[model samples]
Target chain A: MATNSLPKADLTSSGRPVFLQNEIECSILSSVDLECDDIPNFPLLKSGLLVLTTHRLLWLPDNSSSSSSSSAAAVALPLSFLTHIFSTKKSVKTLFHSPRVRFQASLDSSKSVVMTVVMRGKGDTDAFLAKFWENWRARAWENDVQTQTQAGVGSSSVSGSGPGSGSGGFYTREGAVRMVGVSGILRKEQEMWESTDKSLQEAFQDLNALMSKAKEMVILAEKMRQKLLSGSNSKSSATNDDEVGSKEEMQDWLLSVGIVSPVTKESAGALYHQQLSRQLADYVRIPLERAGGMINLIDVYCLFNRARGTELISPDDLLRACSLWEKFDVPVMLRKFDSGVMVIQNKSHSDEEVFARIKALVTNPDTLRTGISASDAAMTLGIAPGMAKEHLLTAESKGLLCRDISPDGFRFYINLFPEINTDDVYLVKDYGIYNTWVRVASASRLE
Target chain B: MRRRPGIGGLQTAAAARDQYRLVGENVAKIRTDMMKEQLATFRTQLEEFARKHKNDIRKNPAFRSQFHEMCAKVGVDPLASNKGFWAELLGIGDFYYELGVQIVEICLATRPHNGGLINLQELCILLRQRKSDREAVSEDDCLRAISKLKVLGSGFEVISVGKKKLVRSVPTELNKDHNEILELAQAQGFVTVEEVERRFSWTSGRAIDALDTLLDEGLAMIDDGHRDGKRRYWFPCVSSNSTPVADT
Candidate 1:
């Protein structure tokens, strides 16, 4: 066995491939073998899940595969190497043979080979071939590569007055006559309404129409992001504070409109779940970072589906996907609390930090007086109430806090248990939290 | 020139040592006697304090309980014989004795209806009616009085089923199964045969049998008024608004 020098795809800690900018997964096929007839030392790449993206084609060893005999290492083939794709054969001879799609690709500029994509798995071979051509021609990554140079032009025109230009067309901001403050805002609002009105009209024309518009929608989102980025950079001094603020707000809204070529059941076939899991592992990194490194599984589901737009996954699928994270070396992980509450947290997220925060929240004078309910902690921590409860319970188990179950409902207070002198219940030490509590409690009793 | 330091000289020194030993013994005896004298004085002082606060000890439950704690630390049982200097001073012994007598009367009165098992709250209600504004009886006072009445027999005791205190006025001993049924009934103040079946994973027959025994013992009441037609075995012994019953 010779050392196979195929391009190694970098996998996320959770086992998802690190995607290039603007690259999106188009389709996936299981039990695939990427073989080049002319290249004999191409490594015995047998029966792995093949994923086609706008930028690259990736192959990962199937979980049930006996690839231990071969180099089961995942490999990526840049789509740029794909010189030509042969149309599928629909003859009776093709029916007798395994379904295959052939294309010309090169590992480098000098060596080219006819690559055969053997799809032993069951799926619409023609549909996969169609998407293969569609993404190849779309060339989404070529646009991302030119981003730095196009940035200046991208920005100036998107500032409400450029000549209806930038990013080759779809979802480009056409422009309004340059104005200041209120009028500019009104014009921005008018432009937003017209875009919505136009998209809605096109979306409802028919299902096929909506499906065709999907790519345009993704491109529009990308274009808006570019415009916003440029609007802030090149025209920061020119634009008023309010204008910049609106642009920033728009940037946030458009930021998550990705997963452009979401892996669908129809596209991914039997590999739907495996591909979806990897995609989810990729999608959750940003939101998980913002949510203090921990978020309820339900929140992740809602956010992931919202960002995905039309590619909504079931709760069962989300759970299975999250569970599969254990097998991969992804940066984020799924954590199930003792209370059966499931959450996603960054692998580097320390419970000690959360406990420290909870300790601070509980010991504050107002909190000491009234204590904190789960909802109150949620408001302070900026998380969902249910997730906050799980945190509170964790803190309680760690002995950082104690629960007070009363008619008012369950609340948590800083654990003053250690400070309390059980030998003499009436005695309050002159220093420490106990005396402070005693003073406040006694004073409050008079009121 | 002054002292022989060895053997027979040491024997003469032993006589002096004996005399010093005698003196130390005498001193120890006197110290012990002094301690006894101080203890006697302390007891007298405690009595005087009790006399000073006799009205407070009698009328105020908080003050009375505090006084009781002080007495307990000194190994004083004021109600031990009910006839003592301590009893005369605070009159706490008589208060408990009176409470006990009233409790006995109420338990006997409710025995026919509740099958010698009654809720503590209902017993308190009856006692208040019998002796209105007398000493302002509390559940704690009732519990203490009943604890004293336990001297009559093992049957006069308080048993808790869930949060409800039941005073069993009969001599029947409840086993674990009966106690568990009562404990389960505490949540909604009542349990049904179906609920018992579901909660304890008991067969319908087993649930009915246990509930029926409780019903027969007057520890529980039955309501057939439910729309679902399930017999709700209401254990007044474990119900929220019922009196604590005592066993015989």
Candidate 2:
């Protein structure tokens, strides 16, 4: 009963591994184990779900098989630390045994061990090994380190030029002599413009060139966003309203730029829908909160796709992903109303909360007199009009509200049906919404 | 290339300028495409980062507001037109517009018993029953379409009394006094002069005037069958359970 000493990987709320900045999941295999016989008292690395990414190999406990073993946590091994991967040998003896891929990796600066990955499940062992080799050779983690230093240099040079003028620093004359007179300032502006024009021309020579420069443009946009964010926070007292407003506009444009590493069928294969379901659960939390714990499935599709940029998922895929939520322990659920409207809602979202809000709305003197339309409830509840209507209907079904149909249009009022004393047609209760409504109605009469 | 004076020189200058402009436009287009691709890639990481710091981002009212602002900007009001991308895609605008016509038909058909004042729930049911498609027409849909009917005239507008909305298709304006009496009558499906006066502290004249007005409008019925000496001004329009079938 030896404890594992491997570094643990951080998992998302839905148990997906937290990926590095540019790390992408390349392949996945279930019921795989990583064993190091070279080290004594090695932890019992049992069959688990092995995820191969560009930067690391992540092993997560098979959720189905290890449901009761809470102690078996996910562990990660950086591909960067790998020294060599031994190719699988084709032999009669290998055919008799479970396919295994052995690799030599440095556990630390001073220690190295030969780790064997035992593939026990019905998976393409050869394919996993090929990817293991590809990822190890790709050296994706090196690229990340390079980008980090590059971004560091880029930002430092940006701040080093002068105090940023918010998003208007694009025309910043970095190395030119500090201009004094207006003519010198104009010359500096002209030179900056020419350099910008020349760079734009060079970047646009062809699509391939532009594709290569795309990463730089993204970094530039991110830098601008950071600049604006910091500018607003730091210079809030000194910035004029117009400058702040323009900076906000720039931030909006940059904020919508795009998302990365969407779970595609090409990458995740059989796990596409499951991973998508988890990714969706994580993505929808903010929007669900902003939408008051419930959002239309169609709306989520639109927002999720918009955030994902070109990696647009089909509505069918979206539905499959949503339906898969039931199998996971995610906090969100997909609900279909009686009218065939699909919605994703937080598990904690209660109809009673909405009902209570509707009740409060219907009892308002103005609402009591005029009733509330779906749009009225929508406005008050900060939800879509359609969703608000569904809530209003649910409230009506619960006898919390009643509808009025007229030439004026459809509206809802607090349900006075249950409060009425049917035994005595003229009886008015001493307390309740009905009584309060009656008082408001009568008071309006005198006015 | 520099500016020239001769006609041929001018032509060459114009051609050079045109070439430069074409390159500039090409670069702009390419830059935009690159930006979109880059943003798409960046968006995934940004969204993940945002999710991790969701609480902090949510607490930043400005961020939430900006997100909502974007949503608003992209949101198309399907009801705004019957022929547009949204209309063609979902046909929701047409659905509601057609539902509105069906609603009118139902109101007209049920006008006799309900007296142009039908409950929204009943209207939806009747509208559904009349349609062969029986397309799911919700009270909300009916409300949205009915609101659109306001353009027809003030005759069609939703009026609320007590805890119920009774659609009044007729042009008659039910003033505050009439609404008060209707709401008071809701509790017991009827109200007497004594109750109205006591509730409003109104003189008998004000109470009786409103009651008589409701009676003349065919909205109220005289229910003197009670053992008590007082006559109950029964508002069939405001009553939840008592069908107007008997009175009509």
Task: Evaluate residue A208 in candidate 1 and report its C-alpha lDDT on the 0 to 100 scale.
Answer: 45
DockQ metric for all predictions: 0.00, 0.02
User: What tens-digit string does per-residue lDDT give for candidate 2 at B5-75?
Assistant: 89999889888777665644543333334333433333333333333333333332222323322222222
Candidate 1 lDDT over residue span A150-192, tens digit each? 5455445445443222112223454744444433534544455
Cα RMSDs of all predictions? 38.3, 17.5
Superposed Cα deviation of residue A195, candidate 2 (Å): 6.7
Q: After superposing candidate 1 on the true structure, give the runs of residues whose Cα lies further than 4 Å from its correct spot.
A: A1-6, A63-70, A87-97, A108-111, A137-151, A158-258, A326-333, A336-340, A347-447, B1-248
Query: Which candidate comes out best when scored by lDDT?
Result: 2
lDDT of 1 by residue, B144-182 (tens): 767655433354556665567777654322123555576
Please provide TM-scores computed only on chain A for all of the candidate models, following their numbering. 0.58, 0.68
**lDDT for B68 (candidate 1):** 37
**Cα error of candidate 1 at position A208, Å:** 8.9
TM-score of chain A of 2: 0.68
Task: Score residue A127 of candidate 1 by CA lDDT.
Answer: 80
